[model samples]
Target: MTETTRTEASKLMTEVEGISGAVLPEPAPAEAVTPLEQASPQEAEGIRQRMAELDMTDTTSIVQFGARAQSDLQSISQEMLSGVKNKDVGPAGDSLRQIVTTIRGFSVSELDVRRNRSWWEKLLGRAAPFANFVARFEEVQGQIDKVTDTLLSHEHKLLKDIKSLDLLYDKTLNFYNELGLYIAAGEEKLREIDATQIPAMEQAVADAPEADKVLHAQALRDLRAARDDLERRVHDLKLTRQVTMQSLPSIRLVQENDKSLVTKINSTLVNTVPLWETQLAQAVTIQRSREAAGAVREANDLTNELLKANAKNLREANAEIRTEMERGVFDIEAVKSANADLIATIEDSLRIADEGKRKRADAEKDLVELEGKLRHTLAAANSSKQAGGAV
Candidate 1:
């Protein structure tokens, strides 16, 4: 492990020890306690024994462990995304809209009894309004039933998603814990190599005879190589642990979304639907009361109009009768006009008689004068005849 990683790990161990009240082993010292080159054969033998005790040369299993954790994280991510995608609440919203539209389409006007129905229709209880109203109610109920079924189906799916998320959360935590254990073990192995094995092997290489030095040096080289491989494995474990840390919150967020959607679905099923149905029932009752009240108001208005019209006609008739009862049979103005017309006709007849008498007197005088003239002419003719005979 890197120095920073080791420091963090040490801090974590301290915190864990404090919480649990358990004593852990102290870390190895930075430098070796004794020089291996100047040591006796028994001391060198002890060094070799310690090296054997801390051997961790084979790292294939450790590497595979980290690779498995990484693979599991990828799988968890894919599953989490799929669950969230499948739990969509859009269909629930669509159902709510349908319910609202169905409710709005219901009309109280349909329940009003017709004013112009024939007498027989009313007597036989054959008014068409109530029938239409009942049909409207049935239609609304059918629509509500369909929307309710849709909402129920959506709620079921959301519930399933919530249960699945619970399992995913637990799996993510397990991976997190396993990575931590693997990293901690790798760190311990690395510490042992640095603190004890590498130092002892170096001393052994320096103190060996000229003929055996090459073998000791090769042994030291092999030990160092193992330490490098162990560090690489610990680094991989730390990387996998980071992935698990990020996944923990991501899973919880998706789970929370699912839970919120479920709560909304429950509210729609338990509260809103029941309240809307109750309100629709109340609307029908209120509409009937309104129709009854309207009929009474219309009757009162017609009675008032008739009373006013009769009173006006009676006032006019009484005025005409009173005027006739107080009047004379023959009005004085008519008698006076007739007498004046009769006198004017008599005066015109007297004037015509006077004009006729004067014309007759003038005609008599002219006839007497003409008779005298004829007698004188007869005497003169007799004389003329006598004179002629004497001659």
Candidate 2:
């Protein structure tokens, strides 16, 4: 039985003991788990919630509220700018100036992944057997790299588009708000001219001596023209406010769409990209594993063949030795001399064979090294050709 099965059985026994009013010993503390393993589910849930909020799904009610507020602001700016100079209006004008600066300086934050080592890079290493497999891995890896580059480029473009939208919305809101304050300030100046300056100019025109009368009349005319300009400004401000207010709903709609897109992109980065990497790694591992198995079979076959060849060589050597012994049996003295010579020859043959084995091993090593280099060069050339073709 598995450890888990046994643990469950023991737990069941403990539970039964507890239920039967028998005292059960307390269990030891569990092993500590890594933070990521413990909190991954919680983190995913948090991402989902945050992404949903950013998506602003079914947020029509809030959008309608914003639309209503924009409408109310339009009416308020129009009504408030009729004719009034107040101390409070001064602060509003200053605030409008600050808002203008703020909107002009606005910037958006961008998200990016840090470039790190890939899993395949650590696996391929400098092994002769794996060289071919590494080449294949690199080929697939090149495609993966292209995909990564494309995805990042797309993400950058998407962020740029969102930034543009944000800039437009901010500019629109600030322009209308500042325009309203400017209209209010203009109306206040117009009130001062009408209520105070105009009457004073008229009185001066009536009571001035003959020589000064012309000058007073000129002053009154200038005041009247200034008042007319202020009245026109009030009309223009009203029209601008109405037009801008109409655009508010549309801008908000676009913002909602952009926000949804950004949220999805973020969600994909968190969930989809990692899954892709995991599956891709698994695929590469399986490929390498299969290649390793094939290599093992090839090596076994080669070893068997080498053993059979070695056996044949041993049989030939033994037959030659038996022939030499049979010839030495013809004369006693000749046989002694022949045996001595044969011993020397056998020793010499053993030394030659040992030298030949060492030389063969060296040649094999060199050949293997050359083959590895050739394979890598060909792989690189093929990759380059493929890239050129793509271009």
The top-ranked prediction according to lDDT is: 1
Q: Alpha carbon lDDT of residue 22, candidate 1?
A: 29
- Candidate 1 regions off by >4 Å? 1-65, 70-86, 89-150, 185-240, 246-264, 321-330, 352-391
- Highest TM-score, which number? 1
Total residue pair clashes for candidate 2: 0
> Per-residue lDDT for 61-110 in model 1, tens only?
43453455456656866876776676466777777787878888766555
Residue pairs in clash, model 1: none
lDDT of each: 0.66, 0.52
Candidate 2, run of 10 with poorest lDDT: 106-115
lDDT of 2 at 252: 57
Model 2, span 1-391: residue lDDT tens: 1234334334433333333342222222212211222435754443233223211123342122123324545454444334222313234234334423432332211001112335664476533434544554455445444443443334344444444544555556655554454444445455666898889889999999999999889878866865675567556765766676566666656445544544443334344445655655775576567667777988999999999999999999999998898875377988889999999999999999999999999999999999999999999999999999998
Model 1 clashing-pair count: 0
